[model samples]
Target chain A: MKKLLTLTAVGAMLAAPTFADTLRLGAATAQTGGLAPYDAPVMEGIHIAIDEINAAGGIGGTTKIELIEKDVRSDAAQTSIAVQELVDTGVSALILPCDADPSLAAIGIVSSAEIPAISTCASSPTLPMIGGDYMFANFPGDNVQATVSAAWAQEQGHDTAYIIYSPDSQYTTMPLYFAEVFEKMGGKVLGQDTHSIGQQDFSAIATRIAALPEQPDVIMTSSYEPDFPSMLKALRSAGVTSQMIGSDGIDSPTTFSLGDAGEGVVFTTAGYAEEGSPLEAFNKKYMDATGSESQTVFNAVGYDLIKVIEAAVLAADGSTDPKALRDAIANLENVQGATSAITYKGTDGMPVRQVSLIRVKDAGREFLGSPSPDAALIPAPRMQ
Target chain B: MDIFLQQTVNALALGGTYALLALGLAVVFSIMGLINFAHGELMTIAGYVLMYCGIAGLSFVIAVPLALLASVVAAVLMERIAFRPVRNGSGATMLVTSFAVAMILQVLFQNLISTRSQPVLLPAMLSDSVHIMGMVIGVNKLAAIIATVVMLVFLDWFMKHQKTGIAMRAAAEDFAVARLMGIRANTVIAGAFALSGLLAGVAAVLWVSQRASVDPLMGFMPVLKAFIAAILGGLGSLRGAVAGGFLLGFIEIYLSAFLPPEMQEFREPIGLGIVVLVLLFRPNGLIPSATLKAEKV
Candidate 1:
C-alpha cells in the first residue's frame, strides 16, 4: 500500500505544468524623436521597477520579468516593425508608445499575435476602443481627466467657460471633453475655438476672446509646452484675465516659465508629489538615476505600468501565457502603484486612476489635491 | 472700429515677422535661383544664441545683437560649407542639398541641445499691454512693427545706395552678366545669405519674445509661412515678398476675427484658398519680378 501511494504522488507531480523562469516583456518605444521627451522618462521608470522586482525575487516570488526593448524612433511604421520583431521573439506582453495614433501601429501587430499591450501615458480613451481588447492604456483616460478639471472648475465658483483646442491629435482635443462635462455640470460654455498644433501666433485668437461681450470666467485648453505658454502670454497681453484651466498636456516646465503669467493657473496630472508619499520616494529615485528632478508626470506613469503588470502576473498564478496574462490584467483592482491605486476592472481597457490637480505659483507647481471625479458624471469616450 | 484697429495692430505685428522671414528667402532665391530651405535653420540658430545669452545672464539689448550676429555667421558658414559645392549643380540638386542641410541641422539641434523646448526669459515689459484709444496693444507687437519698418527702410536704402548691396541686386537681375561685369559671384552670394540671416535673426527675436521659449522645431511653421508668402509675392522679387507677407498675415488675422467661432478651424484652409485664387489669376504673384525669365526647353 505505501509503495502504491508513493507511485501515485510521483505521477501527479509529473502531470503539473511549470511556469517559465523568466517572462519576456517587449517594449517598443520612442527613444529619439518628438515622443522621446515623454517616452525616455517612462523607460527610466520601467527600468527602476524592473530592478525593484528582480531584487525582490521577481513577480510571484519566482518568475522573473525580462524586458526586451526596441526603439521605434517615434515613427508609426517603425512601431509596427518593432512590434512584429518583438512578437516574433515570443514576448508574453508589450509596452507601446505614449500616443494613441502611434501606439495603434503596435496594437495591430500585438492583437493578431494574441499578446496584450499598454500605452505608457496615452490619455485618449479612444485608444483601446479602436485598438481592440488586447490593447490597454495604463494612464487616466481623457474623459476622466477632463471631468476632473471641469468638476474642479465648477467647485471654484466659475460659471462661464471658453475652450481652445487643437484638432491635431486625440490628446490635444481634450478641451472638447472638458466643454461637454463643464456644461453638463451647469457651467455655461461661452465658446470654443481651434488652433493648429504648431501655431506660434495666438494673437488672433486672443483678440477674438477680447472682443467677446463678456470675458469668460475661465479659459480652458489642452495645449502643451511652447504652444501653451505662447497662448497664455498672448491672452494675458491682450488683457484677457479670466482664469485658465488646462489638462495634463500643460504639465510642462515651459508653462511655469511664464513667470507671473502662469500664476494661479490650474492643470491636471497623474499624481501629486506629496511629501513622504510613494510618489515623492519615486521622484527621489528618479532624480538619483537620471541626475535631474522629474520634469513630466510620465515617470510615475511608467512605474505604475510595471506594478500593474506585476499584479497581473501574480493573479495569473505565475503563468506567462498571453491570454492568461490578459485575463488577469483585465480583472486587476486596487493594485498599489507609485502614483495612485490602479484598477483595470470592469472597464474596456482604461484603468480607473486618480487625477492630480496642480496650480502654478512662484514659478513652481503647487499640489492642490487628487480628486476622484464622479464616475456618473464622466462622459462616454468619444470615438476619434 | 475699435476691434478693427486692434486687429490691424495684431495683423501688422504678425505680418511684419512674416515679411522679414519672406524677404530673407527672397534675397537668396533672387541671387542664386535657389530657394534655400535651410533659411529656417538660420532662425533656429539665432534662437539658440538667444537662449544661451539668456543663460549667460545677458540683457535683451546685448543678447539681441549677439543673436543676430550668430545668425549671420551661421548663414555664411552654411553657404560656404553646404551650398557652395552644389552651387554649380542642377536646380534640383541644389534644392535637395538645401533640404539635406536643413535636416542635418535639425537633427543636431535635437541631439546636441534638446528635443524639448528651452525657456528664454525676456523682460516682463515686453508682455505688458498699453491701452490706446480703447485698443489694447502688446508692447512686443509695437516693437515688432517698429523694428520691421526700420529694417525695411534700411534695406531699401542699402539696395539702392550700398555698393555691395547694388552688386547683390545686379547679380539677382542676371548672375552671369554680373559676373562678367567683375562682380564676384562668391562675395555676392555670401552677402545675400548674410542679409537673409539678419532678417531671420530679427524675426527670431520677436518670435521668441512673444513665446518666451525656443525649441528645435521653432522655425518650421514660420519658415513655411514665409515660403508661402514668398510664393505669393513674386518668388524672386524682394518687394513682392514683402507684399505677400503682409497680405497673408492680414487675411489670416481678418479671417479669425470675422469668422464664426464654429468655423474657426477652417481658417488655414480658407486662407490658403484665397492665396490659390490670387495665384490662379496672377500666376507670377502679386508683384512679379521684371527680371522673371523663361528658359527655352
Candidate 2:
C-alpha cells in the first residue's frame, strides 16, 4: 500500500507542469547613440528595483526575478532582432525605451510573442492605443504633461507663445502637441520654427522670435541636452527674455552649463531630483548602486516599469505564462513608483500619472507643485 | 525689414563658415587630387579637444590654441600614416584611403568617447547679441565673419608670396613635373595638409560655437556641405571654393527662412537640386581646375 501511494504521488508530480523558480525580465533598450544617456539610467534603475525586490524575498519568496539586457543601439531594425532574441531566451516580460517610432518597431513583435511589454518613458499618447493590450505605457502620455504646462502657462497669464523644435522624434512631436493644446486653450501660437539636430545657426530662428510683431509671452521649445543649453544661450543672448518653457527634454542636470541663461527656464517632467520626496530613498539607493547620480528624467521609466512588473508578477501568482502575466499587468492600478503614482487605466493601458512641473533656478532645477489639468471643468479644444 | 536683416546676418555667418571649410578642401585637392574626405574628422577632433578642455575647467582662451594644435598634429599624422603611403596610388584608391581614414577615426572616437554628443561650454560672451542697424546678431557669428575674413586674407597672401606656398601651387599644377623641377614633393604635400588642417580647426571652433555640442558625426554634415561647395566652385580652384561656399550658404539660409512653413521641409532638397542643376550646366564646375598645357611640342 505504501509503494502504491508513492507511485501515485510520482505520477501526480509528473502530470503537473514544472517551471523554473526564477522569473526573467528582458530589457531591450538603446544602450548607445542618442538614447544611451537616457536609457543608461533607466537600465540602472531596473537593476536597482530588481535588487530591492530580490532582497525582499523576491515575489512570494519562491521565485526570484532576474534580468537580461540587450542593447538595441537606437537602431529600429536591430530592435526587432533584439526583441526576438530576448523572447527566444525566455523573458517573462520586456521593458522598452520611450520613443514611439523605434518602440513601434519591436512592440509588434513582443505582442505577437504574447508577452507583456512596457515602455518606460515613451510619451506619444497614441502609443497605448496602437500597442496591443499587453503593451503598457509605464509613463503617462505627452498630452498629460502638455495639458499641465499649458494650464500653468495660462495661470501665469502668458497668452501668446512661440515654439522652436528640432526634427528629432519626441522633440518635434511633443512640443507641437503642446502648441496644439496651448492654442486650444485660446492661447496664441505666435510662430513656429524647426531646426534639424546639430544645426549650426539658430540666429535666423532666434532673430525670427526677436522680430515677432509683438514679443511673445513665452518662447516654448522642444529641445534636449547639448542642444538645449546652446539654444537657450542663443535666445538669452538675442535678448528675447520672455519666459522660456519646455517639456521633459530640458530636464537634464547638464543644463547647468547654460549659466545664468538656464535660469527661469520652466519645464514639465515625470521625475525631478529633490531631497525629501517619496523617491529620495530610491534615488539614494540608485546612487549607492550605480556610483553616480541620475542624469535625466527618463530614469524613472525603467524603475517604474520594473515596479509595475513586480506587482503584475505577484498578482499572476508567479506564473511565467505570457498571457497570464499580461493580464496581471493590465489590471495594475494606483501603484506608487519612484517616478509617480502609476495607474494603467481601463482597456487602453494608458497610464495616468500626476505630472510634475519644474523650473531652472540658479542653474539648478526646482520642483513646482503638481498641477492636474481638469478633465471635466474645461476641455482643451483640440487644434489640428 | 527686421526679419530680412536678421536672416542676412544668418546668411553671412553661414557663408563665412562654409567658405573656410571649402578653402580647406580646396588646398588639399589642389595639391593631392585626393578628396581628403577626412578633413571633416580634423574638425571633429578639434571640437573634442575643446570639449575636453572645457570639462577640465580650462579657460577658452587657453583651450582654443590647444584645440587648434591638436587638429594640426592630427592632420600631419594623418598624412604621414594614411595619405603619404598611398600618394602614388590611383584616384579611386586614394579616395578609398581617405574614407578608410575617416571611418577609423570615427570608430576610434566613438569607442573612446560616448557615441552620444558631449556638450562643450563656450564663454558667455559668445551667445550675447548686439543690436545694430535694426538687427540683432549673435556676437559669436559676427566674430566668425571677421575671423574668416582675416584667415582668408592670410591664406591668399601665403599662397601668392611664400616660397613653400608657391611650391604647393606648382605641385597642384603637375605633381611629377614639380617634383622633378626641385619642388620637394614631401614639403609641399605636408604643407598642404598642414594648411588645410589649420583652416579646419578654425572652422571647427566657429561651427561648434553655434551648435555648442560635439559628436563623432558632427563633422559629417558640415564637411558634406563644404565638399559640395568645393565641387560647385571647381574642386581645386581656391577662388571658386570660396565663392561656391558663400553661394551655398546663402541658398540654404534664405530657403529655410523664406520658404512657406508648409514648404520649409523641402529646403534641403531644393538646395541640393540647385547644386545638381548647376553641375548639369557646368559639367567641369563653375570654375574647373586651371589646366597647365605643355609648351606645344
On TM-score, the candidate that comes out on top is 1
Chain A accuracy of model 1 expressed as TM-score: 0.94
Model 2 per-residue lDDT tens digits across residues A1-384: 756755653454344222436777788888765666667667768888888888987767766787888888777888888988777666778877657667778877987888888876777666766776767776656677777888888889999988887655653556676787788888999888877765666665666666667998987776775567667766777778889888776666556556667778888888665677657767787778878776665666677878888777777777766788888878778788887778774747767787888888886777887877776422232222
Question: DockQ of every model listed?
Answer: 0.54, 0.41
* lDDT, candidate 1, B36-96, per-residue tens: 8888888888988988988899998999999999999999998999999999999899999
Error of 1 at B12 (Å): 0.8
lDDT of each: 0.88, 0.78
RMSD of each: 5.9, 5.8
- Across B143-204, the per-residue lDDT of candidate 2 in tens digits comes to 88898899989998999999998899889888889989999888998899899889999999
Reference A-B contact fraction recovered by candidate 2: 0.44
Clashes of 2: 1
lDDT of 1 by residue, A82-194 (tens): 99977776778899999998999777688899999998888899998999889999888889989999999999999999999999889999989999999999999998889
In model 1, where do residues sit more than 4 Å from their true spots?
A1-18, A54-65, B294-297
Interface RMSD of each: 1.4, 2.6
